[model samples]
Target: MTTPDKPLIMLVGMGDLSARVLTLLLGHDATSRVVLAGRDAETARRRGNLALFTAANLGRHADIRSVGLDLRNVAATAETLARVRPDIIFMGASLQSWRVITQLPKPVFDELDEAQLGPWLPMHLTLNHLLMRAVRDSGTGARVVNAAFPDAVGPVLDKVGLAPTVGIGNVANIVPALTHGAAHLLGAPVEEVELRLVAQHYFSHYVPRFGDAGEGAYHLDVRVAGAPAAVDHHRLFAQLDNRLKRLGGIDGQLLTASSAVRVLHGMAADSGVRAHTPAPGGLPGGYPVRIRRDGAELDLPEGLTVERAVRINEDCQRADGIERIDDDATVHFTERESAVMNRLLGYDCTSVKLGDCPHWADELARKYGEFAARFDT
Candidate 1:
């Protein structure tokens, strides 16, 4: 059994999936310590009901308490890390609630920089960089597993020397659910199914809901490690259909959180997994990741070529902003996405790309400037 000093896990955020994660971690390995943290106990508890329900449904018998944490007080987070001496830290605290923009008139959104993914990149990436620093400062050998917008945030965190041990949740996260259904229909063991995906956020965002990608769902191929294997596309799609059915019409934040869970569970498994997230920690788009038992580490998993990854991201980035970004140059936030961010927070702020963690402290302040002002009581 791993002792207390061996390494505990620090989970930031008390959202539904965050608690679900705590429960899953305990159910998966009860001996290990799991810290379920957040800023407000009341809100955390309120938001954590789904997690609690999911835990009970899973029949998790271990005790995982809700820990309150104020992210604004960065030092407190540092203190928690110092105390837990965690082996793995999962940062799922930040909220990725950008669905509102989708509801606005396409004409208005299409014209603004907020329409692009880059503008608000700073909003999410800033939170990640701060937390990454806390994890690094902990100095324990704990590997950190990050959730949320890793396609952009993970890489930015990496550039400043505070990269996640591994990033969880991305396009790669959605592939497995498809793989399993294909495996079952083909009568092949799930392990034998191999999938190669070249996808972008646009597909990840709209496909499951609208099935509007125009590509007839996602194109997935399965094969035994070295041999070709048959796949049942209809059955495979049935699985995707079921998932979207359940997730249909739900709040975007809730759906994103659920997506977070699928990614988390896959990353937690025994076999190694590869995913694309924002790596080099400050890049414009996502970078691929390699996940192992101890923690997630950076490496563009072997199958896909770097050139292919870059080209896909560049295409996605262009669709996001009014001006297209250069494929080779690191991309940052866009004007439309930034406008949406301003409308949401009532401020105009920009995101720092992969190399800008040092500026994150200021950026976060600017991003949160209004909300903090209005709510300061």
Candidate 2:
């Protein structure tokens, strides 16, 4: 049912979250043609066919297929992208998920917390860097939506001129959850509640639990029925406790997927529109963005300049243990994060040069696997 004029969306991961996104896309009016690409072509094909079957069962027809995509091989990836020339690309590829990393004991987690979650930035950046290069070389104006650690990775990629169009999750996820809480508190319909959040990725992890997020600077603006509505942060955040949707290995993929779909929908729409996303065009962190058919534009709330917004998010990165992302795309980890990595995993990487990301990713994956296994038994 796909026509030549319709858009082609390429999804470059088939992990737990990616698969859920595929299913969710197929269940709705996903008019675009989707190519599910991964390192395992056969596995991707199997998942693609399953998605098609599910679509058929739901009385929907989907233009879905699969292909092999090894992001490490830039030449091959470029050749593939040049041939397909997809309109949009959604990258969900990572060696590991944050869920696995969150399974450590509280004391151990807190120790690692001092360094924060910044040590894992390389794992999230490796494949995405190469994929962006492939897009650039292919000469295709493909809008990319990164689903990795965009809170930090987006700026790193942007520094090297390989920034994705926008980042998924983070603020995108938080805004909706906050909106739902705001709507419940106001006794208004969810759609009637307009929520804007200027924050970073770190807040999503603990906000739903303790509600004390982002070093005590969680910026949020709420309005109901086109009228200003004052929100009691204490009361509003108290409702978030019941919405703790992730536990250990399990995650709230449904929320992440729904938010991502909105970004994609905005991409395919004719005119530009606004949505909350993390790291739009590789800016420091999450911001409200005006997504267009071609790309996205930063739509930061009124009175917030680009520098101030970037400064706020950049300062927030320390909570995740990333000291700074230099002009050359080099990422310097905080001393605490480096020491904890060395002591716990016998691995040491204080700074990561962007070009050296491939090697770092391979080593970090092995080390993280070993670290996670220690807790399994």
Candidate with best lDDT: 2
Q: List model 2 lDDT by residue over 1-377, tens digit each.
A: 32434678899989988887787776556434799999999999999999899889889888887889999899999999888888889999986677665578877776665556789888888888889999999988888989988888889988878899888887787776788888888899999998767787766665775665746344677888878799888777766777533432355777888778777877765346678888887887788787777666887656778888888788777766788999999999988768988888777999999989878878988887787787776
Which one is best on TM-score? 2
| lDDT per model vs. reference | 0.53, 0.80
Error of 1 at 259 (Å): 6.4
TM-score of 2: 0.92
- Per-residue error (Å), model 2, residue 56: 0.6
Q: What is candidate 1's lDDT per residue for 92-118, written digit by digit as tens? A: 766443443444455654443234454
lDDT for position 98 in model 2: 74
My TM-score estimates for the predictions, one after another, are 0.66, 0.92
Cα deviation in Å at residue 245, candidate 1?
A: 4.8
Misplaced by over 4 Å in model 1 are 1-7, 30-32, 41-60, 63-66, 95-116, 176-193, 212-221, 224-246, 249-290, 296-303, 320-331, 334-377
lDDT of 2: 0.80
